[model samples]
Target: MSIERERPRILFATDFSPWAAQAEAYALCLASTWRASLTAVNVLEFQPGMNPEYEVNRLFLAELMKGATQELADLKSRVAARGISLHTRIATGIPSEEILGAARAEDSDLIVVGTKGKTGLAHVLLGSTAERVIRTAPCPVLAVRAEPSDQAGKDSHPCAGVGLHRVLVPVDFSDCSLEALEYAALLAQRSGSSLSLLHVLEPVSYGLDFTLSLERKRGEMRERLTQRLAGFVEALAGAKITADSHVRGGLPADSILDSARTLPADVIVMGTHGRRGLSHALSGSVTEAVLRQSRCPVLTVRSPKFAAGHRRVIPVS
Candidate 1:
């Protein structure tokens, strides 16, 4: 996709929670700014049971769907008046599954979700539906957390704007990281924000093949990162999005957080493979780590269509 192209549409999924409301507001603002359409989806969880006639169950389900549909419809006119194209949908099933299905069904460029950013016991218990959606969605997922309670109470008026002044993008020089950087650059361009490209030089043990000294390893790491950053700069030059790239030696998650904190970014964008089971548990750690510690909102993109020079740059609606 051309970096200059605008975001045409956004898929905003709401659970009707306070956090979801915050997500809707942010998504709607962007839609208006980009002149993009909005497709809002609400996933309803149905009670599980069996009935011979199923009459009562049917009535209950109908009422639930109708209420959600009405709520979305009400939002449509207001959002549309702000220059955003609006559509509403109601589905019954698992939240993550329904959310992903809605994105595919609408051919949305992005998924905007509101999260609590739960910590401690809550974090372990919730396990993060936002993370799951990030892994599964066809497009990028923007996880918006409610403003800190202290801040919210002080200011009755919700914060305004896309808040994209500085964006943090973590890179490993993998194809996935390249895809993420391209998307991030486009977003930075649109938002008129600076870009921070970071690479985490993970420590090497060499196992039993400990022939290379620590100094040699450090030298090798510097050379590899220099080549990577140079190539990245060239790519950005072609797209016209100015960016700063850096290499730091540490754990991947820690380095990502350190870079983000140093920049004090308004947003962070990254890519994931949507892994599951044992692999997912391990791979999901980086995403989990950043989301837990970062002060800014985070966007996660998972694209099966990603390829060198053939990446699809979804507009930053």
Candidate 2:
């Protein structure tokens, strides 16, 4: 999708939690900057034991809905004060399922959800909804963490990215990565953000020693790949997007996280695919690790094609 060519529809699936409020700031920031219509949705999670069809349960549900409406109204007013007109909705059922449904139903161009990022422990357990939404959203998904990393908080405010300055995109020279670059270019165009492209190189064989010949070959490979990275930067030249790239040799996730941390990127834009078992230029495993460790929000572009287990073409939303 040409996100630059089209005005995108944005959906913020909020749970009214403190972390969700963090996500709201990002949704509001993007909506205000992009001038895109924003919708805030809250799902009323019905307990399995109580059926809403009964009188007591029905009244209880009514009370919750009444409260939610007021909360959404207050949130609307808050964003409206920032000159952003907000649309609101409340859904009933599973949070992740309902959120995915809402995005599907609305044909949203992007979905933003709040997450609490810390050391492992499943990373984001906003009902584990943030992780699920990242995996299966119809369009790009923005995972906004509750706060910045300790080191980052001293120097900057992660939530104040309404005026983005730098975007870090990890590329592995795959079609999926190419798609991510497209998304990043548009973001850079709109936000005047500089693009940092990273490519990580790993040893081709597990037990091989780095002999003189191997070192020579590695140098050749780095130069070749660096040229390819430059070609990508050249492609963005016409749009006047400031873009530069680098080639690093290490674990993909570690290298990516390092670049993002040192650059203090406002966001990391990359791509993910459902493909498993076989190796691709970039794997879901790498993306998952980056999402868990990065100090900034990760905007993941879903690739239309799949490999291995799920080989069907994904329909555009």
Best by TM-score: 2
| lDDT string, candidate 2, 28-58, tens digits | 7777667677899999988567778999889
Worst 10-residue lDDT window for candidate 1 reads: 150-159
Per-residue lDDT tens digits for candidate 1, residues 1-317, read 22234545578888777667767766876665555677889988763464424898778778888888788777776665555667888888778888889888877777888887777777655667787788677888889875633222122222354476778888876666767777787676666677878788888666666655766968877988877686776667666677777888899988887777776777888877667678765555687678767666788766733234554432221
How many clashes in each candidate? Answer: 1, 0
Q: lDDT for each of the candidates? A: 0.71, 0.75
TM-score on alpha carbons, each prediction: 0.81, 0.83
Query: Model 1, stretches more than 4 Å misplaced?
Result: 1-7, 47-63, 118-126, 148-159, 205-212, 304-317
lDDT of 2: 0.75
